[model samples]
Target: MEGFLQLLLNGTALGSIYALIALGYTMVYGILRLINFAHGDIVMVGAYAGLFTALAVNGPAHPDLFHFFIVLLAAMAVSALLGLFIERFAYRPLRNFPRLNLLITAVGVSLLLENLGQVVFGATPRVFPDIMPSMNWFQFGQVAITNQQVTVFGTSLFLMVVLEWIVLKTKLGRAMRAVSYSHEIASLVGIPTDKIISFTFAVGSALAAAAGILVCISYPKVDPLMGVMIGLKAFVAAVLGGIGSIRGAVVGGFLMGIAESMVVGYGSSTYRDALAFAILILILLFKPAGLFGKYQPEKV
Candidate 1:
């Protein structure tokens, strides 16, 4: 039972990280209708940024929680700016191109970022500081939860809530929704589509950076390729929740997280990812639109 509980805790923590990255994918897809393949690489960038900041700040001395917070903010800011820059340079010009071409370009960008990351950070994995305390937290009957799990769970929930509020209540968010509905219409109505898109990427990337930092806390390492698997999982979560739906993204992330955990807990842990894909297949076979995503017929 303790073993099961341990797996569950780890699974939820992993799921939270997946959901964070997934939110970025879903948000960009929701607003701009672009996949932004490089977004995952941005999360990688955030991990590296935090790792560098941590190492640079306190060296191998293990910074405190306060220091981690500062490093997190710095990573978020850097990733957000890079998100905007990518949108302006890579995506803006290709906005009107064939969707196929745009997807190809997105892949190109993803590869480019990975290569750049390799060049800059090298191909080696760097160990991140264990900034969060490892002390045990409250127990759920027989289940022991650690401070790291609590921090991960709490932080993920807070970010999701803050994001939901921002999307539902803010004026910038209103502009964002308008653009999502119809970019040309939004432009006609005085919404700056470019600015809004850039802002959307900024928000998405910032969330991803936070997720990356959180991931580093648990996983305690960063590498150029770190974002690849996580990115794929996040994309699956985003799709499972409905590609363009924010609430769906959140829902899909946790669901996928739980499903993967269950699969690992009971069956072959190696097949955990296969379980995620299986769920995706089932979702597509029956719903087609995703669990939280609304289906709209294509215009002929």
Candidate 2:
């Protein structure tokens, strides 16, 4: 029972990070119906941003709460700008072209980012700073929870709630939904469709940045190619929940995390990575639309 509880806590914490990244995937797909393959690379960039920020403000040895928040904001800001730049320069021009063109462009952008990252950040892995002070928050029998886990989970939940509010309560959200339903109609109704799309990209990228930082907090390592595999898994989580459904992304993330944790605890660590792909295959074969996704017929 204690072992199960420990796995559950760990899984929830890890799932929150996946949910944060998955939210970005769902949002972009919901609005533009294009999978931004480069989105994952943004996570690597954000982690680097946080690393530099921490180094600039204070050395990694001293963990300060204020410095941590500053680093987080800096990373988010840089990521948001990168996302906006990608959307405006890479995607906007090809918007009217066939979606296949956009898809290929996305793949190209992803490769470019990965190669650029290797060149800029180097292929070597760097140690992420200890931003949050470490301490145990809970202990019961053989189960223990740390401050890092609490912070990761709490921050993720807060961000998710804020995102939900933005989508469901704000005027900006209403415009976003309008654009999602029909871009042409939304433009005709006087909504700034282009700006809305750019904003969506910015927001999504920021969430990815936060996830990147949180992951480093938990794992304490960063590399230029770090985002590749985790990004793919987050993409799976989004698909599992329904590509365009925000709530579905969160649920799918938790489910994937728990499943992975259980497998590792009760089974073999070697199969951990393969498990995600296996679930992806099953989900695709059985229910491609995902748990909360609705099947939409493509217009001829």
Give the winner by TM-score: 2
The sequence of per-residue lDDT tens digits that candidate 1 reaches over residues 1-300 is: 887877778778878878888889988898767787898899999998888787778734654677778788889999999999888898889899988887888999999999998998899888888776678887777688888888888888888998888888999889989999999999999998889989989999999999999988888889999887778888889989889988888878887787787787788888966776787788889988888788999997
lDDT of 2 at 102: 98
Which candidate leads the pack in lDDT?
2
Report the C-alpha lDDT of model 2 over 1-300, residue by residue, as the tens digit. 899999999999999999999999999999999998998999989999999998898847678677778888999999999999999999999999999999999999999999999998899999987998999988888899999999889889999999999999999999999998999999999999999999999999999999999999999999999999889889999999999999999999888888888999999999989988998999999999999999998898
What is each predicted model's overall lDDT from 0 to 1? Answer: 0.85, 0.93
**Every model: Cα RMSD to truth:** 1.7, 0.9
Worst 10 residues of 2 by lDDT: 59-68
Lowest summed lDDT window (length 10), candidate 1: 59-68
- What TM-score would each prediction reach against the true structure? 0.95, 0.98
